[model samples]
Target chain A: MGLSLKTAVAIIEAALARGHELRLAPLTVAVLDAGGHLVALQREDNSGILRVEIASGKAWGALGMGIGSRELGERATKVPHFFNALAAASQGRLVPVAGGVLVRDASGIIGAVGISGDTSDNDEACALAGIAAAGLVGQTGARPAEA
Target chain B: MGLSLKTAVAIIEAALARGHELRLAPLTVAVLDAGGHLVALQREDNSGILRVEIASGKAWGALGMGIGSRELGERATKVPHFFNALAAASQGRLVPVAGGVLVRDASGIIGAVGISGDTSDNDEACALAGIAAAGLVGQTGARPAEA
Candidate 1:
């Protein structure tokens, strides 16, 4: 099912709340539909200016490859050249790092969320918290063994 | 003062409401800070996937040049070559059209809003309606006489 604006906003609110609770830095969050179109986004005041693009890029890359950015980060190390090419092809929107998670439902993948501002792992934690808050599943694209 | 996420969402909500009232096509709206960075954005479902980029480009161009895309469009007609070069230089982010508008407070130009997915004029109308809805002034970059 397509992600509604309400749900996207809920996810953003929850994500930011998690950041606030953890006393992390101000955050930026982006929710992208399956087609990698922005459904909703918010950049907290005083967040770095580039946070929005970086957040959206992380989610866009995850949605584009049907994998989470964490897994993509791992792969980037094995084949740096390929990941570089991918970044070029995607117009520098493929940010292969943590904080990108696939939003899933019983049907399949519905959308993705990306967060930025804190450490990659902390950002990913917020994403997962937000997804759970919205009663959806998040996949970080971890291999089954690692997961 | 900077463009707060709250004000940005208010603009998007009012813009979409205007579009719905007029029965216009699905619209995508983007809000950008004075630094030409995204503050918030939303694309209505079924709107073209490229709407996000187009909307952001429209606002980005306005903030980059300190004028609205409507004026930019006028200039593009007189200097096609210059405008073409500008497009290339911005990495294809400058979109000269009617829908981009500057958001102003009493202090000065604070940010910009862009709308896409309908005729450019209609898109601009929605942007104006939104800015007004938020109790802010919108500058379409129309010449003083035309305005």
Candidate 2:
């Protein structure tokens, strides 16, 4: 019912490769299936332990809202209380930020990719590049530069 | 990093088939990745709404303790407070019962499979058989009837 683990791992690898290419800080990337479950996760050396959790939170948030984290983040500004309650409801597994991007296949959103450790825009860029490298689409919305 | 969604689904299908072969009650099975996030889930028709949640809780508990739920269940009797706190920390996602088993490949523990909607022993047996069908191992501990 969602993206394959092989593809999910590919996305994380490609995202890490982009981080290396761009000389960004160490990053952690998490991929989640359509059910908002972790498929594959990778943390580059030196990425703090919390980065992985944060990345997972972003991906979970994107999957939960069926939108890119950027969109969710924007929505949070209008309904901070709601988002806060959601955060509590989700056991703090919600991170509405720019780094979470929906991964879409030909059918629709198969899953999501999330990145942490760099600037939010750059993290989202890495996530998008990673998804693209895997021959999938990423929903980056109105974020800034790609890389 | 985790079980592939494909393999997870395969495990559930195999478990469901086993349930039919054994003529047990309707069942719900859940597969979770190494990080304890649900990868795939299947609730047979007429299975209670709580079946999915129960399956997830069992899988989560197995993964959390790095042991089969059977063993965890045994431990829970001796140290109920610890298990209680764990359940709270996990937002009520802990079910240390016989139906939860670890999914392992040659490398190590890849994920976990959990079943509900029937007797715990029957549920664990189905989980073990399903893992075997998928060419993976299910850590059923020393629990009786299924090994």
Candidate 3:
């Protein structure tokens, strides 16, 4: 099944609760449908204005390429020159790093979540929490065939 | 001085060349002035339709906020609520994440470049090349200001 706006919003709310209970700093959360369209987004008041863009970019990248941002980050190191050129070419939508997770149902990828503000590990944790809250599997542990 | 159309074209050309040389796949490139207005855009054959929007959003966010997209990515972690609201409010124009860079002359920020198709790192590299071709510094290292 495709990711619905309802699920996306639920995921964001769960992430917010986790951050608050853990006393984490402000955060930005973004969810993109499998087709890489924005479905939901949220940023805290203390978060920088740019967070909105960053969170969206990460989720977009993950959904666009059908893989985790962490995998992209690993590949970037192997080809810095190419990666640099691509960064410029992409006009800033590509982010090759952790803190983003693909959402999966029984069928396939449904959507993605990207969080920023805390450490990468923490951000990923929040994403996972949100995924679980939405009653979907957080595909962080699954390796895409392309990866 | 604002980034001229000529400079923006130069950046796009350089980025395209790099993409071809690296065999990075079809891509889309966009250039924005310091104020986040579009100056030029190019979408390579076979690239997805959404590539144009992704690249444009990245560059627009970088140029509008006067910082690298990576910094914006970090900020999103702490304040997702506000970030998502802004993304919705921006109507797909704002993207905060690594893969876009500010174009800087000796004086100050002239514009920005954003590329998409390959990995985020590769897109960033292409933007850097375009900035260099335009005889400007690619401010990939600079972080966005805190909100």
Better of 1 and 2 by DockQ: 1
CA shift at A142, candidate 3, in angstroms?
A: 6.3
Interface RMSD of each: 1.1, 9.3, 10.2
| Model 3 agreement with the true structure over A1-147: per-residue lDDT tens digits | 588888989999999899988888678999999877789899875454556666776676677567787665566566655555544455566665677789888898888998877666788789989998988887653464332
lDDT of each: 0.90, 0.82, 0.75
* Full ranking by lDDT: 1, 2, 3
Instruction: For residues B9-47, write the lDDT of model 2, one tens digit per residue.
Output: 678779989999999998878787887765655566556
Model 2 share of native interface contacts = 0.00
Candidate 1, position A27, lDDT:
94
**In what order do the candidates fall by TM-score, top score first?**
1, 2, 3
Error of 1 at B104 (Å): 0.9
Question: Which residue segments of model 3 deviate by more than 4 Å?
Answer: A141-147, B1-147
| TM-score result, candidate 1 | 0.91
Candidate 1, chain A: TM-score against the reference: 0.95
RMSD of each: 2.4, 7.5, 12.8
